[model samples]
Target chain A: MFDTSTFIRLLPELILLVTALVVIFVDLYARRRTALGLLPGLSIVGLALSFLAVFAQWGTREVVAQTLAADTFAAFFKMVAAVAVILVVLASVRYMRARTRYVGEFYAFLLVATLAVYIAVSARDLITLYLGLETLSIVSYVLTGFLRDDKRSNEAAIKYFLYGAVASAIMLYGFSLLYGVTGTTDLQEIARRLLNGDVLVNMEWLAWPAIVLVTVGFAFKASLVPFHQWAPDAYEGAPTPVTMFLSTVSKATGFAVMARMFLVAMPALQSSWTALLYGLAVLTMTLGNLIALRQTSVKRMLAYSSIAHAGFILMGLVAVTTALGQPFNGLDGVLMYVVAYAFTNAGAFAVVAAVEDGTGGATLDHFAGLVGRAPFLAAAMLIFLLSLAGVPPLAGFAAKLFVFAPVVRQEYYVLAVVALINAVLAAGYYLKVVKQMFFVEEPERAPFAVARSMRWALWLMIIAVFGVGIFMNWFAFMASQGAAGMLGL
Target chain B: MVPLSWYLTVAALLFVLGLYGVLSRRNAVAILMGVELMLNAVNINLIAFWRYTRPDNVAGLVFAIIVLTVAAAEAAVGLALFIALYRLRETVNVDEIDLLKG
Candidate 1:
């Protein structure tokens, strides 16, 4: 059951698992406050190394033990997860230091959670997939409530846990139905059986229910509409760094898993699910943007905006339609969108974390006249906000271009038009934040200093946003290659 | 010999009842218990399917075992969250834990 090739294939995950264990041990011994600095340092080193391991495995494709698959698609998302976690840890150094005492578990769980995402995206078996999802969910619940003293944090964690448990239970029930119908937990095997009509002839009616039930779990994870109530509360209540991770890395994982499940395992049921996703996509974007228009708190507004972005990404999936073994451009668009979004959303939340550190407020008024106090931060936030609004020459605009191009190419005019309206609605809210930071004036407090690690993280995110924006052709090509590899095209 | 449909019917009823409990209950612990009931229903479905359809294969059995293990872990985390909520707000009522809104 075990072999050397499997170990080699999982080198990145192995390094992360080892690093997580070491962080726990390090935390236990480093009781002094000064020694706490080493934890985040070690965590970053671990993440960077894990990133290198993934890079080394590029272009390698193999399935380990009929459960985990190592391929470029998994490698691409591993890099995204690693980069997001590194940025979150860097941003967290000062934020967590200022708020809580359990610094070690915070860093350790970050590594563990990153590892879980790797497992999740690579899973080819239902058992492995479920375990990876639960691991990510559990670690996230703890991380959300890291500040035990904060009532908001505690309440957020409770809500997240309650919602998470029920969602997972429902998903498990779906898995059971699927397993019963197919008689195997291997995803590809199930696909083979369903495609060859070995299973469907006897159980055709069960397929739609199974697909709908499975979508419920994924929709919850991705914060799709009607299943998205927990997002704003969890995002607003959690620590800003955790909020950054949740919006970017956590959401990216959901999309990654959703793409894999739909494109790889259940291609037989594509027509029905794509139609379902079309309706969900329209509702998610409209509701997410319209509600964000009324939010007073900047954090809560970003939370809703993240939901709207989820809708944008979902648009790519809804447009996917393959024939004659040719790969769908919609999947390529989705892959690019996920990478671009990881940087943009994380960068936006990092700015919020820095501002929260400077002033203990999170409302729109807190950002007034920000340009005067911190020009670099305000400039960076401006770029991120513009990018999010899909302004030209930014990552968000590039991402939106890639996603909508395929929908238009496929002659999906109605989806394209609805998306255009949603884009305009999204810009309205994002521009309001820009107006507060640049135009509105409040000159009462002294200029504040951003922490060293936070500054470095912000610069890295700024570079990524521009780099992806300017080199759109190169990144799009890479994303398409990864998407093609996923489909074995 | 019992038919497969009977087991599925009972499990579906249990799952529906659990879902109703989860949606209607206000107390956090009670909601967690509802989640537990839902998981148990899943376990029954898994075992029943395994015995009737795939008696020669071990995948279904292993899946049920994993589900049981994961459900316990989920309960532990849920209870810990409830205890944390109690310590913060002096009550485990989910409705009262609304420090965040709109």
Candidate 2:
């Protein structure tokens, strides 16, 4: 069943896996100075190749090796994951080095985590998806506490681990229920059986409960409200670069698998799941923003904001449908939003990393006069913040437009309105940082100078934010294609 | 042969019990133990379903085995994290491990 063609479809994952292993071994033996430069460099090269592997498979739409699909949908999310990783690694170089001596292992773990997400989105069945998510969780737990000596980091990791382990176990129970109902672990087979009514009615009722239990897992990963207690602490405690990874790439992975599972395995359960997601969307958006509004710490504020963005992303899933060519077909908005948010959010966190690097804290006092201290960082922070607040001429605006349009089309006017209000609510906090940077008097300190590598990554993120905004129509179309391509459009 | 329903009921009860432990336990290791119990419940559920409905198919068995492996891996990582936390604060009680509150 598996052949050379299948291998090409699997190439991105293979390349990343090998790179992760090689980096670990190389770091073990290489001199410290050489290892530091070589590890990040090797990781970027590996990720760039993986991104190309995904790009090259852009139009190929087929299930490979029975459990993995090499389609545009997976490729789109994988591309987003790859881009997010490369940028984080570049931005991470100096930031991570300062926090820990095991910089090489950090790069290796990052690669492995990326590979896990790639597997997750591409998975066509329950087993592969479960394993992929668990791997990501295990690695993320370690990364969250990478600052082994730091009490806050350790607390965050253990909290994250407890929550994550419980969520995944609960999800596995759901999978077992689905397996029992359909007598199969293949997602497509389960969907077909459910749709065909092959299972007894009592047995059929199992799928609903199964779906609810599984959502608990996805929600924890996405940090939806109620399951989101770990997020703010983790985001506040982890080293800033790891926080960037957790918020952007890791969060995107959660959405990727959730979207693929719903769109692929539970198309028959659309009406039910949509209603469920609609409630979640409202709670996640409202609660996330309300908590964020009062946060004094900028990092904690972003954490809440990211949870709200996940809620916004969930709206696309709620309004999802097969009505191709309709503007804001729900899935496209999810895909577009994931891509746009990854770049914009990572950029915002990078600015956090830069500020925290210099000031040793991300509190308001630390950022009292950021513009005067580090003019370029303050300027970049302005762009990232505006984009996040859904201001026009930026990626966040485009992302919000597509996702919000679908909610309106789906007649979820209440969700749309809550989101719009949340956007405004969210802008209040994002702009708070902007005001602090631009308006506050310059604090007493030496003028800041960002690391050269981080400066380059920041420039790339700025260009992407503008490029994604101006060329939104094209990205929107690509998102449409990716969503449509999953169903063989 | 034990009926599938019997296994299902037992596993579900075990899962709820484990969930209670997770919610009620203060020690991080105890929480990890709670999670292990829940995972074991899932495995029991998987195997029972396989034996009852799809005994000829190895998918269920494979899934159960994989879950077993993953649970071990998760426990390993969880314990390591707890050790690190314990060293820092001299306790595994999660309530005291609160340096990250807003």
Candidate 3:
């Protein structure tokens, strides 16, 4: 018999949903000016408590009626999403209050979006995954246009909505094709059927197309090269907190879905998809870095850099397929990279937001000699840029090393070399930001005040970035364990 | 009874038409309509698959419902964005909204 315990297993998401609704309700009764200040703090506490609840359930695996699978991987991503929510709330307390209206709604949406990401990473069946992705995407669409008074924000929101809708539809169509071919929406069941060899081999042509469509859908979410057209403008146009949310938590969730689907369910079809991932890995990394070099807007540069990092994560996927003749072990690289990326990218965006607060703009020129004006922000930005460039003694370098280690172990020398070259190219642009900040003359009349909450957020993010790198082995172990559980090994 | 291929082919054609509309149309609202058309094509394929392949299981039916709900949410947010853009720039043309272009 179906039981109430099943519903209890989803307590964290329930809490978030309740909090979001309560925030909406409470905002109506409170003074408008103070509500903006009070709501984000309340949401942060709720998110932190939800994270604790999810943490308590770590290592407890359950298949919720063949739809959602509450597992360690879900717990790991939930923790990450919770961290993202906390940082977003902290960053937005100052950023949103000064620039945008409807602050309570904004914080509520962020929490709801985090809940969606949690569900997305945990979804065992196709339907649940689709629902989760759509939820995340919809909230993001609204958040991107939260600054409705800003023309760029409005434009960004429209473009994001149109492109995201198309991608979701394509993804759904692909899911339908898979369902048609396999007659099952449960990933595990589909994997078992495919491994049986008779149905799959007999319908190889149909199977290939179905796989292609499914991949295309996931690829759009991951923002792989060909499907990444929406990222830059959207990241630039959205308020800075939303940009950080999209770049870190949203991208990480996309990879989680990709890892779950391809590594677990579609391992039988590695022969077909592995080569495709390799091509995408090379293209995404190269294109993202090359284009980022020319961007004058700091936000857009990070946007492209995030796309490049997506490519780096794809390399780990490629390693999973080609190296060790298995996909499971390759996930360690992906997990570590994501953890490292979450901290460094969030820290970088925090610095950008701080700079934006000071100068009231995000252009590259605005950051000239930022070190002279705001030494702490400059130092934080330097650390983030260096970490992003994969410099030694930083989390980004450790992430790259983890990703490349398996490739070397498996002797995929050429792929590792390509990744190395991309890393070097990435450093060129990241260093450009650093050089402009520290070595150039201070731009006249740079606004240099950072809100206390934003400053704390930046410090925390920087400390996390450096701490993870310094304790690389421990971080790697946690990442590897999470990956191992996701692969069910 | 209509063959499954007939339904699939029509769905594919509708998807292509939607893609064409999204790519060629300058108006944001038209692009949204195109997106809706594409989602409808997907819904058709899902229901057809459920009817033909997984008749015993209702997962596909459940997924179709979820997709429809999501599509509605997407349209709401999208139209809101269009309204916002219309108010800000007094136009919904995609080409005219390229302020951040390099």
Candidate 4:
């Protein structure tokens, strides 16, 4: 049953897994040899190869009988995940080497984490989706605690684990309920059954609870409000590079799976879930922004800010239906917003990682007169913060435009107003960081040398931020193809 | 032959009880136990649904087994994290694990 054609389809995953194993073994020996750089070099080669593998599999909807999705929707996220992971590996080279001894395992786990994202975005079956999410979750747990000697790292891992375990279990129960009602694990089959009405004769009431429960699970993963208790702590305590991965790649997995499940399996019950997300969007945006206002720790501030961004992304999902042109469906806005935000937030976190490296912490005190100490780092951070605040000529601007346009067009006037207000409130804190860097009274501190790899990662993020924004046409087209693949059903 | 609701009822009770333990427990290990119970409840529900509804298909059975296996993995990882925490701070009581805060 396992044919060569299936092998061709799964080429990217195969290459990543093989790279992970090779890194682990080579690192085991490299440790005794003190050859610190080989694993990252090998990992990047694997990532570059998978980039080609994913490209090879493009426009694959015509492919028959594959377990995972071959559509542009999944393909788009695979691209995003690859970009994020590559940036993270580039940046973490020196930082991680300074902190831990298991450098090879770190690189290996990072590769496996990327494979998890590939599985998740491509999942068409409930069981496969569960596997993808759990794989990412477990990998994240290990990565968060990788600094075994640090008490804070241990605390963060336990908090993340406790929250993650219960959430996934609840989500599993939700999946079981859906399975009981539909009697099929395939998402399309479940949709067909749900829409048939006869299949739901008396079990119709179960659908609502199932949706609510399933959402609880994904919401926790996505770190939406009320279920977001662990995010700030975990982000604040985990090593900064892992924090970057968590906020960008891992969070994207949550939205990818959420969008697929709702848009594909449960569009028949659109009104119910949309309404649910609407309330979550408001609460998440307002609370995430408000609390971010108080965090002195820059890392915790970014954590809450990421949660706020999740709310902004949810608005795109809420306003799913639109007369906006092809691929301009609410989901495409979510996709474009995500693609843009990935670069911007990553750049922001990369700067934070650098500052932490120099100052031994990431608080306002560390940032004071940053321009005098590290003019280039401060300037790059300023651009990232501006982009995040939706200033024009940056990726965050394009992201906000794509998402907000849909909500305005849908005439969700209240949600639009709330989101707009939150945007302003969010700007207040972003500028606070800017103010610390530029307006402080501290004397010039000596500049610290950022590793070459870290500099390269920052440059890539900054360019992508500008590139995605100014060249919005190309990314919009890619996102349009992705959304079309999903809803063309 | 037992009715389906009997299994579902037992599962729901177990789930709620586990949730209670998770909410109220201070010891990290006890909380892990609570999470294990919740996962077990999910397993029971999956098996009962499979047994009663579609005995012909293996989807339900397969899902239950996957959950069982993953749950063990989750517990193992959780325990490892707890042990690391215990060694660092000399206590695994979550209430005392307060180094990271607002």
What TM-score goes with each of the models?
A: 0.98, 0.99, 0.96, 0.98
Error of 3 at A72 (Å): 1.1
Q: Least lDDT summed over 10 consecutive residues: which range in candidate 2 chain B? A: B93-102
Candidate 1, residue A48: how far the Cα is off, in Å: 0.9
User: What is the C-alpha local distance difference test score of candidate 1?
Assistant: 0.89
State the RMSD for candidate 3: 2.0
Ranking by DockQ: 2, 1, 4, 3
Per-residue accuracy of model 2 over B1-102 as CA lDDT, tens digit each: 776789999999999999999999998888888999999999999999899888899999999999999999999999999888778878999888777786
Task: Identify the superior model by DockQ, candidate 3 or candidate 4.
Answer: 4
Q: Candidate 3, clashing residue pairs?
A: none
Model 3: per-residue Cα lDDT at residue B100:
63
lDDT (0-100) at residue A83 of candidate 2? 90
Where does candidate 1 stray beyond 4 Å?
A200-202, A324-328
After superposition, the stretches of candidate 2 with alpha carbons farther than 4 Å from their true spots are none
- Point to the candidate with the largest lDDT: 2
lDDT of 3 by residue, A237-297 (tens): 8899999999999999989998898877788888778888888889999999999999988
Top DockQ model:
2
Docking class of 4: high
Sort all candidates by TM-score, best to worst: 2, 1, 4, 3
Interface Cα RMSD for all candidates?
Answer: 1.2, 0.9, 1.4, 1.0
